[model samples]
Target: MKRNEGSFEFVVGLNRYWLKWFGLWPHCDRFSSHRLFVTLLMAISLLIPMTACLFESNDFADHIEILSKLIPIIMVTIKLFILRVKRNYLRLLVEEVARDWKNFGQLELYEKDVMMRYAKLGRLINIICIVFLFLVQLGRLDMRFEQSEEIGYSAYQALWYDLSPGTARFFIILILRSRKPFNITAGKFYIMSMSSFMNILKTSGAYLSVLKAIK
Candidate 1:
């Protein structure tokens, strides 16, 4: 539906665009061309690297490397699949949001303005979370050792490894048969996040001066 920029449906329509782009929306038919297009992309982008990594992962770091790079794609693909499976419920929720906007539309202009202000604020917040989500997900597109998802990926990696889904079960069993945590630990800790490392670098001059004094 075409709507004015200020119309409540504008935001809802934008949301629909994203949902459709992610393949969990609008067209849920078994033979939807859009869904087919996205499914092929997911299979090509998600499965191929995962399978390659599973076979090539000879050590924990290798596993972590793949997990860090693939975890976001895995997570996003899973989220879409789950939502796609529950499309009926998702449709109901979207209708509820639109229905609520209909109720607001009946109010006085000032009242509608107040409500739109809050709704737009909420939409802004949603965009922020999406920005962070995208930052986390961006790690998956690269095959290199991206630090963006290392911390969160290990958490999910443990979950994926423990759940032992399909080939991961046998692959992990073979690779981690006798591996210890410290064997893969740098200074007895996983090199999981770069955020704190930035903080450390920010204070390196102070630490350097202290080291010079001690010498």
Candidate 2:
């Protein structure tokens, strides 16, 4: 079967396509200095809401709401730093893998089977992560709309600033939604590394068992 590398047409073409258009998908292949700059700018811009939530809100719930939104931006910033520092290593790994694809036949049957299983598991995990991200986004939107409804009334008017047409709240929600912590490349890297580490442990255990049996 053919693979659709760049196609992000999941869930009625809403979540994936939107994320790709906003430069959020294919996190590894899309990294560049300009994209990094834009990401940093947006992340720094989040400080406005962060500060507002910290000093302006006296309620604990408000603090939680704001922090939830800021968490993704914070994560993205951290991921960017990691990617920048490891760019050379990552590039080399990618090149090596591409060049070595023709050598798959050299692997033993068991090793090939393990690799095939890991490949399927990785794809499944990625799909689950994407779906979870979409759901989280929808939940965020629902919470924002609920907050907007509360702010529209006279009782909860004092909780939020009366900025004319209420563009401040809208902008804050927009930033929160747009800056999600769902980088596929980073996530896949983490999952694959963890899986490889576990596999190594399992192999070591099997070897020790065989030695004990021989003894």
> Across residues 46-120, which tens digit of lDDT does each residue of candidate 2 receive?
866697767888999988878877787788778766766776775576455443443446668787567556656
lDDT at 132, model 2: 82
Q: How many residue pairs clash in each candidate?
A: 0, 0
- State in Å the error of residue 89, model 2: 1.4
Error of 1 at 31 (Å): 7.1
Quote the RMSD, in angstroms, for model 1: 14.7
Off by over 4 Å in 1: 1-5, 27-33, 40-45, 108-114, 129-215
TM-score of 1: 0.49
User: In model 2, which range of ten residues has the least summed lDDT?
Assistant: 1-10
**Candidate that would win on TM-score:** 2
What tens-digit string does per-residue lDDT give for candidate 1 at 1-215? 22333456645655766776666665445545477466758656776868698788799888886786577667766776677678889888877766667676467889878877877887887789877775564333332244433544454456465554785666455445323221222585644334444556678978999999999
lDDT of each: 0.62, 0.57
